[model samples]
Target: MPNPIKVVLVEDSAVAREIMQRLLDSSPEVDVVGTAQDGIQGLDVIAQTKPDVICVDLQMPRMDGLEFTQKVMSDYPRPILVVSNAVHPSDVDNIFNLMSAGALDFFPKPTSGTATDYEKLKSALVTKIKVLASKAK
Candidate 1:
């Protein structure tokens, strides 16, 4: 079997981080190797872990996601999947801007309030990560 994809999650909210970790753990093809609470810590973790994919939050403390994405793209150029609660239609332009800046794609914060919500999003997340990771390779 192919090696499981290594993922580093960088999210500030405790609940959101736990939810994401749980979802990622459910995937057989993916592994949550490390996690960070902010962009600075995320950067450190990325450097240390060298994960195949990094899931980051846009509004983190100590260095927001956009800045981190810019730096990572400029230097590391790894696959970055942005997770955010900014789902308003008005934010589409800004989201596009993030995509242009570096992030491969963005996903809505899972709010299903149950395991089913995570199960649905997990499939999409895994597909996205696999595609991006393959391209990065």
Candidate 2:
């Protein structure tokens, strides 16, 4: 990417937010312009930053990714990527719901442990963001 893709992250866990930010920031192709703890704050950040793609958690305080995705699509119309570990349902209802709510993609929240884990997280996250960024354009 000639210019880094502007991104907004909406996650309730401070640790998860920080980890994801670091992962995204590791790639020169991605620029995490802003982050919010929850969807209400996410709305404000989204409005201010006008990111090219948004990364959101499915389960959050104040508002969940489903509602957040709905609002963002109607109000701002950006590509949304729901990165969450919320796929416990046998049928993967969370994934379907978020997709219907207008998320462009979904990924399991990356787990950090080994060097390979970090490398995999970096590649998958940046690749997803790159793909979603194109959808927004």
Candidate 3:
């Protein structure tokens, strides 16, 4: 088998972070190499892990996802996937801004707690990660 896709997760919410971690853990194609609760720490984690892809939340403390994406694009330049709650209009702007800043793709975080929703999210997440990793290769 090939090496799993290494990923660094940056999200401020502990519950959201845990949820993403669990979802990624269940995917055999992805690997959670590191996780950070804020963008400041996320930078350090990214540098240390040198992951193949990054999963980030937009609204975070210390530094937001847009800032993080700009910094990473300028420095690391890896595949960044925004896994955020894009509920508000401002969040839509943030998502677009993050893309312009060099995020490859994004998935709006699921609002519902249904298992089917979670499964779809998981499938999309894994598929995106694989595609991004393939492009990187």
Could you arrange the candidates by TM-score from highest to lowest?
2, 1, 3
Steric clash pairs (candidate 1): none
| TM-scores for all predictions | 0.92, 0.95, 0.90
Task: Encode model 3's per-residue lDDT on 15-118: one tens digit a residue.
Answer: 88888888899988899999999899999999999999999988888999989999999989899988887624466677678778999888776544789878
Best by lDDT: 2
In model 3, where is the ten-residue run with the lowest total lDDT?
A: 86-95
Clash number for each model: 0, 0, 0
Q: Model 2 over residues 1-137: C-alpha lDDT tens digits? A: 38999999999998888889999999999999999999999999999999999999989989989999999999999999988888544547777887788988887786667888988888999999999998777
Best by TM-score: 2
What TM-score does prediction 1 earn?
Answer: 0.92
Which stretches of model 1 miss by more than 4 angstroms? Answer: 87-90
Candidate 2 local Cα displacement, residue 64, angstroms:
0.7
